[model samples]
Target: DAGITQSPRHKVTETGTPVTLRCHQTENHRYMYWYRQDPGHGLRLIHYSYGVKDTDKGEVSDGYSVSRSKTEDFLLTLESATSSQTSVYFCAITWDRGTGELFFGEGSRLTVL
Candidate 1:
């Protein structure tokens, strides 16, 4: 990964609150994704963007949304944070879809009470 960063590496919020996590990349990768990691769930995709303003829902898209208006940044937002959504969220980037190679940012840990 040439450059990838996740903001607010850690956060704590009350239930029903709104939260947004940011993932930014410097290499202008064409594919970016948001995934949540939890016990026994491994990594479940929440959303992905193929290019600027082009996004699609993923396996676990409920209560989550994503946007990528610029090639360098991807945003993952929870309309209303809930206890069930508490998990470590990760941002990943890939050069292309066929290569199956993905580079991930450090991660963002969210705690919902």
Candidate 2:
């Protein structure tokens, strides 16, 4: 079975509205990350947390934020939605500091109009 799951699975929102997406993990891992996958660009990290309340921005951090108040839950927020944010968002977890491979969730598809 997979280790991660993302909520909403799909969503549609108008421009300038705030949105939040949730990610849950049962793998008991130490690292959780939020990323967006777009055509041609592959996967780009939005944010990541190594421990509760310990988070950091990623490559595409603008207009996005994240929180991890517990071991199994991580949340991503979009301050104000825009058409550029319309993409498939994925949550990933890594087992340990050794192997770098990531286990991904089903994904949340958000469309901003």
Q: What C-alpha lDDT values do all the predictions have?
A: 0.92, 0.92
Judge candidate 1 at residue 55 and give its lDDT.
98
Candidate 2 lDDT (Cα, whole model)? 0.92
30-110 in candidate 1: lDDT tens per residue? 899999999998999999999999999999999998888899999999999999999999999887645867788999999
Clashes of 2: 0
Per-model TM-score on C-alpha atoms: 0.96, 0.95
Candidate 1 residue runs with Cα over 4 Å from true position: none
Candidate 2 lDDT score at position 100: 78
Give per-candidate clash totals: 0, 0
Model 2 TM-score on a 0 to 1 scale:
0.95
Worst 10 residues of 1 by lDDT: 94-103
RMSD of 2: 1.0
Tens-place lDDT per residue, model 2, 5-84, is 89989999999999999999886778999999999999999999998899999999999999898889999999999999
